[model samples]
Target: MDIQTILQELELLSTERTKKTYIRNGAHEPLFGVATGAMKPLAKKLKKNQGIAEELYATGNYDAMYLAGMIADPSAMSEADFDRWMGTAYFYMISDYIVAVTLAETDIAQAVSDKWIASGKELFMSAGYSCYCWLLGNRKDEEFDQEKLNKMLEIVEKTIHNSPNRAKYAMNNFVTTVGISYMPLHERAVAVANAIGKVEVSSVKTKCNVPLASEAIQKAVDKGQLGFKRKNVRC
Candidate 1:
């Protein structure tokens, strides 16, 4: 219900080993080493409380910031709140997942995505690409601007290989997300991914490899997972 209470809960969930691992993955101190799975039940209990969510994010605690995303009412949050969150985020997961998901749920998604991608900040640009990924995956064709989307694909084609590490990774994920989820864009997205080939994202802690976008989408197609729209981006 409050920052102290949630922080305490998260603290109890922290483990020294996980803390060390998280630090290597780009998270800093003041974060409890709580697993994301552990945060979900807590987030569910605090769901839809924008005020509490804001307080949690302002704590600058990684676990709490991620919790804020789970509880946020994206529709209720003002654009100013998102702006603050995006600009202040100190971790990749906060920017790429929490901030991106909230932005996708709002009407200003594409506008902010464009603005952030154009910025010099790596975090903002990564978040922007991540937001676009969610936007393209969850929204219907009628709701999207074909011109802008087309332009984004072109930008990826031209700049993805030279993008900042996380930005390149996010862009690749965006390609797979669109190619796998949007039927009409599948061919184009695959073409772009094939042309870009394997992407490299620097990760110090995780074994997670950046999948070739084309192969990832192709796997989805093989499993008949293509063309499935996610009703919500939170998952």
Candidate 2:
């Protein structure tokens, strides 16, 4: 489908409640606030469309940008292309959920994410760690280097508290994901989460919540979901 048609469909699907929720979560104007699940039918129709995805993403509409990620052909995106996308990701919803999730499907996921993690920019660091969480949840355990993941756990253990709020949240998610998905580092991740303890991240609404990685990991364990991996990273 063309950008205009898809955008019109997204607009028709948008609701005041969802728009308000998005606004509360830091989304600005020029957004339709269409729910993620509401976009599935259109996504199923278009499948992968890099050209259309780029067109939609460039519109700077939140729902359009999200649908772009849903239809984007990650294999066709170069690191430069991904970087371009990241540059426009102004908030955590766009940076972590859209750009990072799309990046997770690419072969350059690790290299690009590593650079972003070291970029020292808050949103970039958040997206970097979130990309790793997506990777760990979707990729096979054998695909990762155990030592690299170990060092990342060490990095989180040492620096998560000092990291930016969004990055801290993603870093905590990384620990929980590692504990749940990467069998080789399950114990190490559990230990890291225990050491890190409660992580407080401030929100736009002035509501601060402590995300406990240890609790999240234990919840997964309680469900017997250890070593779990997703079939797909994108919806």
Candidate 3:
């Protein structure tokens, strides 16, 4: 479908309740607040379309931007394209879920994420860590370097508490993901999780506690889900 027709459909799928929830989570105007699940049928129809995805993303509508991620051709996107998208990703959902998730599918995922992680910017760091989480959870353990993951666990242990709110959450998830999904660094990740403890994330609504990586990893262990790998990262 054309962008205009897709946008009209997204508008029709929007609800007041979801709009309020999006606003509460930092989304501004020019959004339809269409639920992610609600976009699946449309996504299925559109598949991967880089041209249309760019148009939708340029609209600056939350739902459109989200749909852009759903249909974007990650292989067609250059590092510059991903960086351009990240530049305008104003919030965690867009940065972590959309930009990072899309980047995870690319061959440059690690290199791009490394630069973002070291960028010292909040959402960039968050998206960078989140991309690792996505990568570790979906890719085979053999694809990662054991030493690199070990160093990352050490970084998380040392800086999680001092990291930005969103980055702290992603960093915590990264540790847990390494523990559960990457057998090479499981023990080190467990130690890092034990050292980091609970992470507190502050927002306008309240101070939320990011789950302890140790506890989350242990739950996966108890369920015999250690060394787990997801079949896909994107919905």
Candidate 4:
């Protein structure tokens, strides 16, 4: 895709009343997190395009700032660059997006993991959890380790269960993205429900609503076979 074209499209999309409602109503924070996660590569491409980057930064939208951070080159960026980009330009932006992009782009996962664990920011932790899950899920393995998978599921479950009201939406976005069609998602959902003292499995259904996997998940659950043990994890 043409990065500039996509950025422009997103800019226009963000201007619509429907989109503006999210910002006006304070839902823009979490929405921007999701957008940042999905648009990192696009942001990197735009960073090299000075005109587009300037326009985006000039707009001062939280989403634009988060996207700019996603595209920033850490290797070439100085502490001064971070100070100016983060402190001066987009003061309204969340620090979570900065941490997320840093972890996502850097090769040093352990270092990022340590930093996030120490920071104890929910959004950053959620982002780290997601990035690690993606890394583990995509790795080449002769057999899937149920223990490790269960641990990952537990992490997501705990996040959703313990999330504050303001961050619940953000947690949901993370769960939906990580859980999209993975059979482990069903177990995670159950754990989340049990942890939070609710019976709402609808979130899982909603996440997979597009391809209609709810029925299949229900059937599997009914058969006493719906945990991470199932082989058909990928959708």
Q: Is candidate 3 or candidate 4 better by TM-score?
A: 3
For model 1, residues 100-128, the per-residue Cα lDDT tens digits are 98889998888888888998578898999
The digit string of per-residue lDDT tens for model 3 on 34-70 reads: 9999999999999999999999999999999999999
Question: Predictions ranked by lDDT, top down?
Answer: 2, 3, 1, 4
Local distance difference test values of all predictions, in order: 0.84, 0.93, 0.93, 0.44
lDDT for model 3 comes to 0.93
Q: Candidate 2's residue-wise lDDT over 1-235, tens digit each? A: 6678888999999999999999888899899889999999989999889999999999999999999999999999999999999999999999999999999998999999999999989999999999999999999999999999999999999999899988998899999999999999999999999999988877656757666889999999999999899899998
Q: Give me the runs in candidate 3 sitting further than 4 Å from their true place.
A: none
In order of appearance, the predictions have TM-scores of 0.92, 0.97, 0.97, 0.44
Q: Looking at candidate 1, what is the lDDT of residue 124?
A: 90
Off by over 4 Å in 1: 203-209
Best-first order by TM-score = 3, 2, 1, 4
RMSD (Cα, Å) for all candidates, in order, is 2.1, 1.1, 0.9, 9.0
Candidate scoring better on lDDT of 3 and 4: 3
